[model samples]
Target: MSPDIVTDPSRAKRLKAATHAAHDRLDKSIMRLEPFSSIDRYALFLAVQHGFHQDVDALYDDPALDGLLPDLKHRRRLDKIAQDLADLGRTAPAAGSKPVLAGDLPTALGWLYVAEGSNLGAAFLLKEAGKLGLSEDCGARHLAGSPEGRGLHWRIFTTALDAVPLTQEEEARVIAGARAAFMRVQFLADAVFIPSPSD
Candidate 1:
């Protein structure tokens, strides 16, 4: 069964703070890491916003670096990553065991985890793990999610089931964190839609 997210208040507060801090830090760091071109910035934003979608693709598209990740090589890597994620999503439960949720992963704040196509599963997985206090192979690595390339950084928790088999405590934290991150991404999307006076 899914953990109830509403009753507890503390988890709600902590997740809000953590996600906001993450969003803010990502924004500032991206600006420092890339040129001011619109495409560069947007590419970076997508890495953060649609993290589960095209991080590897964006990295593969980089050109100025010269042989760093040539076009053909980049495409191949992205294709492989996508295929792996898809395989993970379609994997069946072990014999005599049933799925914990209807889908491979639960939808959080209307954002379904997109495996085999993006790094979103990694993001959600990281967040969920934090709530459960589990350890991960990557040990909270950032999973890139940036325009320049895929990168890893230490995150809070690990383990895919950390988000799953959640306790009442963990559930509330996941919901709050998911909601806040969702709102932040939505705001970023809306900002992209706004027309400037120069336009």
Candidate 2:
């Protein structure tokens, strides 16, 4: 099932609209860092991924979220990301402060939405990793396509996400959580992708 096939009035659509600006800004910021310019730069990019995934690692196991999304546990990529870091001989960076969603299920869903949505783009990143001589079994495991494939995986998630019941206030929190998720990635990217003194 392609995501395009799932076009319905949905929380997924709403969240996408709400976070568009933040998402675009983060994309530009990451591109500015030129993460794919070299193996070293790609390693830094992996570190940023590790940091962000670590922040939301626990949410994959949240009972409430699991009930909402099918096979929620399988959606986690933190372990894959950690392995990718190790494959590059880089230690996984410590997770930053806890996510703003904390124990809030609605907000956590929002964060998960952003995290899961990123997988769709990972296909392209995985190609870039190929230029660095990294493959799914090597230094790019975290970016590999799921067995179900990216489009189907995303469609399944958004279908689940759009169906989750929330009040108007909770919906607002979901948007806030998504924006915060983007901000967190931007922060991590900035911290890890710092230019050398010669640059």
Candidate 3:
């Protein structure tokens, strides 16, 4: 079944609930790939991140979604990512180009769900970075938890997401957006680096 079908069992318009379920269902295999296990792997991860956000951050300018999630601009990490790549002697690759957003707010929020939720995963990834001697002050800014704190910031987004009243159809688009966001990350990951059979 398509991963987005996780949303099929969901009837509520609560974007948080639906999106969270989508992440849980779809990201397990991607997460298992352990993109931060080494500096090369980590750098590739950073490049793809830079590419994805550089592609999607324009969604922040969408007045419809911006009105709902104004702090969207404040959440950008492309600059941090570019610096991290530079520290690693890498450049923002051509792969860092724009991603497709389907041109609407709910779709943007679906993408936002993927982006913000990634921040919540930082506490774990930060430790992996530590294993490679990377830190918030040095080569791993993206894995550094949100400046405000991870859990609290995630709660703020989820609260806003759940509070928005979506139509049944809008909720579906949101789910589709979240799924697309995951696929983009996975696609870029494959573009930049993929573990060999022995790994």
Candidate maximizing lDDT: 2
| lDDT (Cα) of model 3 | 0.73
Where model 3 places Cα greater than 4 Å from the true spot, the runs are 1-34, 95-98, 195-199
lDDT tens digits by residue: candidate 3, 1-199: 4343333322324445655655665466456767667788788778778878877777766666666664867877878888888888888776445565637767787888888888888788788888988889888877777667898888777767776666667777888887788777777767667746776
Give me candidate 3's TM-score against the actual structure: 0.80
Candidate 1: segments with Cα more than 4 A from true spot: 1-6, 9-12, 34-166, 172-199
Rate residue 164 of model 1 by lDDT.
35
* lDDT per model vs. reference: 0.34, 0.86, 0.73
How displaced is residue 21 in candidate 1, in Å? 4.0
Ranked candidates, highest lDDT first: 2, 3, 1
lDDT of 2: 0.86
TM-score of each: 0.26, 0.91, 0.80
User: What shift in Å separates residue 139 of candidate 3 from its native position after superposition?
Assistant: 0.8
**Which pairs of residues clash in candidate 3, taking residues 3 or more apart in a chain or in different chains?**
51-96, 55-98
